[model samples]
Target chain A: MRIVIIDDSGLRATVLEEGLRDAGYDDIHIVPPRGAFVARLERMAPDVVLMDLGSPSRDTLEEMLMVSRALARPIAMFVDHSDDAMIGAAIDAGVSAYVVDGLRKERVKPVLELAVRRFNAFAKMQTELDEARTALSERKIIDRAKSILMNQRSLSEQDAYALLRSSAMNQGKKIVDVAQALITASDLLGGGL
Target chain B: MSLRIAFLPLTDAAVLAVARERGFAEEEGLSLDLIRSTSWATLRDRLVYGQVHAAQMLAPLAVAVTLGLSQQPAALAAPYKLGVNGNMLVMASDFAAALDPDTGRRLSDPLGTAHDFAAAIGLWRRKPVIGVVHRFSSHSLMLRYWLASAGIDPDRDVVLRVLPPSLTVEAMRAGEIDGFIAGEPWGSAAVEEGLAETVAIGERIWQRGVEKVLAFRTPWLEENPDIVDRLLRALIRSASWCDDPANHDALAQLLSDPRYVDQPADLIARAMSGQIVVRQGEAPIASPDFLLFSREATPFPWRSQALWIYSQFVRWNMVEHGPEALAKAGAVFRPDIFRRALADADVPMPGANMKVEGALGLPLAVGSRKGGLTLGPDRFFDGRVFDPERMEDYLTNFVSPL
Candidate 1:
């Protein structure tokens, strides 16, 4: 997996880079503290992002938050010290792992693995949520279309749904799509039968 | 109560460090955990999110947070001021050479130096990029106030870069920025390495300018009033110790720990004693009132000071002026809470919640709870007095860039 390390300190970046290298991860990129850091990360599109900030000012945190929001990769941030509020903000900004006052060479591999795992887990959950939301919205649209058909044709709810399913099967389309088209046809015809 | 507090690695964090190190917290039935953060943003977030019970925050930052400028809008409160007037503006040595030759005179006269800075800006090859600790920092506000007095528009004339104070010296070394304004000993660190020279001290811009504060989330503070009171009492005791000349060495040593400031004792001691070395190999200047920790009601959180910060925000067009926002900003500095915490202490408490900021030309007696409260000079270098009561008039008086 490709790794990108964002650190303002040259010395600490070297330490983290060396640790990552020893763990047999060679596709590592170190970003300096100048000129569109997030843009550079986007171009690199690393699998995981590691940031070691000696002291992160508000500006830096905001910039990092922008990157976290943009990228789907796992991100692990290491700081010399952190407050509860900062940690919360970082998490809210989508950081996978936040290690405080624990910048050691041996700790890097474990943290990286854990961060990637957590990120994958979070991504899976998010995908599930999105799928569920889309299904629920589609179900609502299908129900609305069924009710419209029933009102126009004087049919039962079950008959309206059966007609929708049969139309979808004959056209090789989703029930929601057929329902949507029927609703559109009725609306365009000024709601008459 | 067990309290975890966040602080930056600066000399101004001495009171918090000493409070935890010298058993002051323990004496008040509190266990203090002092976490050293690298930037004001992190420390502010720590307090806002309930990660730490409190934080050593920039005076303006606390106000800005309450004003919803920093990040998420959260009501933050400052019950105690940690230190006053400890920050300074430093320019690269090459940049300094273009300004003033006499270091002592340049350090003393802000107006003269500011004019020199304006001239230097003209002669410079490019728009000089100066690093400030944070956008809402007192250092940035002071820099803008100083530069604007010389008719130098900060936004148009120069590039104000945001950087962490600890990395300022390195940024200067890399030529990423030409100068930086931050709390000691970062500025002193730059001077010590022959990289920069002190241009204007915060004290010279505004004597006893509000700097760091013991800031807490408003909800957390309201819920834990007794805990807040205990923490304030401990901090007040620690502030007194920090102010005492006898404990300067010990305080410096404690601050020099790798966990805290992590600088040499002498460098930290210079700020603690108010004897600053502006340049390498030059005689240290005796700036006796360089930093005030406890005396002169320095710990009291004046609502007027918060209004003054709000005025600067209005001046900079950072926020629109409205009575509701102004009231919220003014309420951030809880003098009532300070009075409540230190009611029985030997320390004298100010009788009123607000005062005419920068009105005191010299040490003057003021009505106090315990009597004998003598406030020191708090004159703005531009000779502008800010009456908290007349905020709209005070704001209208300024020729703000907006």
Candidate 2:
């Protein structure tokens, strides 16, 4: 039931430590990305060694390859199956995993489960942040689409949203789809579509 | 019509690049599609599995695939030698200058430059670490073969590691590696940047060594024999175009562009022109056959080159035993396929076997070079003489005149 976290991120480690503590895990330990990292890795020998997903310490991880191999410990990490396309993206993104061998597969589930949740949470946060920034641009696209609709049918703002909503209901499409379609068609026509 | 053939974008991959930019592929109803791959393993995987129809591969890589050196119990049957030469050894300047006294003369062997290099490294106070692009590559074997011939222990005396050709210059600059053997742009780039000195051009070691070749999944080549023929014809034309001095500027431009080497064209042209640029501040020496794609270098698919590669396989214990080595080299190197490709385009085929004695020789004064056993150094670590006569014949069987 004991696990140690070895990551370069202090803030991430703090949050993980707090979360695990709240989740009733008493033997959770955290180590930073410097000296004492390997000693802690060896001394703690936790059931799981949870490191930050994309820290810029791959060389450190790579340097550990020989030592890990010499010790006959094969480390594997969670390859993001939920996002298959992300495998290449992750390799590009510097996301990698290393789990020591001899750890039972079933016992490692919790480790991977936590890592996936953390990664998903991080990804979801990124998506939301991107969306927030693009909200203005998306609104302008909708405005462009709306202007075209208004010019074509003399529909007001209220009528336009209503029409779009009704169209979504009929076609089972999202409002973004209708907005995108309208914007694309209008651009192609050299003005309002 | 253009065909999108995937290729690992390296400097020595001249024929494919020339075909695309010089309109040679088009001459044979082929459009060039050169995809960049990070590793030969990925290149082989994609080419073998049909993700990509064909590619410019390590000559031995094709042989390895055909011979099953890589994925044993699963051998690939493919045809064609893609291209040759344009590889060299680049050593840290300090190491290059530190020649061992016994080497007799100042280091001067270009073809087997690494062999003399192994001598220099062996006699060094510390075992010198050598870098090559890949474990299965000829660069690795060449370095090992040269070292073994000089009576040096490849494993004990030197630390060998693979650093991708693209990263070698940077690695040399950062001092992470002592020296490296890699194809064109990487070696040339090192000299241009003053990071490493060119120790030797590959042609001087094994003479007209087989460098790169087109390899495809057996099933793919079988189904598209006409396309293969067309592709080969285009490649040959590109090789011819590359050989012409008039096309030098164009070849340089194609490789220096962001799509290919993405380095300075002049540096790449240094190798492409067969001008041996030593990494040290020495003048560039002319080795006419350095980047040969056409002329006498084109056809013949010299069996000697294939045998040289097999000699290394035996030396390294990569083939611990048996006819697997010969079969492997035979399977991937399809001179027959290359000839078929050339014939369809009406390109005249060269001789079946070539005499490379002119390029084979020894260097004056190995640079701090240690001594190596004269034969297979790894499997026969006790300094036993391997049957070179037998090995040579085994290697020449598949690709020789027949």
In terms of lDDT, the best-performing candidate is: 1
Per-prediction TM-score, please? 0.75, 0.64
For candidate 2 chain B, which ten residues in a row score worst on lDDT? B373-382
User: Candidate 1, DockQ to 2 decimals?
Assistant: 0.19
Residue A53 error for model 1, in Å?
A: 7.2
Each prediction's RMSD over C-alphas, in Å, is 23.7, 11.6
Candidate 1 chain B, which ten residues in sequence have the lowest lDDT sum?
A: B40-49
Docking class of 1: incorrect
Candidate 1 residue B195 Cα shift, in angstroms, is: 0.3
Q: Write the per-residue lDDT of candidate 2 for residues A7-122, one digit (tens) a residue.
A: 66565566667766776678888777554355456655555556553442333333343334334454544343454454444333323345565666565555555555565555
Residues B1-402 of candidate 1 have per-residue lDDT tens digits of: 789898889999988888888999999999998887776766765677677899999989899889887655789999999989999899988788877788889988899999999999998999999988887889999999999999899978998887888889888888889999999988988899999888889999999798888899998889999999998899899999999999999988988999998999988888878877778889989899999999998999888998889999898888898989999999999988888888898889888998998989989999987969999999999998989888888877878553
lDDT of the candidates, in the order given:
0.81, 0.61
Report the poorest 10 consecutive residues by lDDT, candidate 2 chain A: A56-65
| Per-prediction share of native contacts kept | 0.47, 0.00
lDDT of 2 at B15: 76
Q: Give Cα distance to truth, residue A34, candidate 1, Å.
A: 5.4
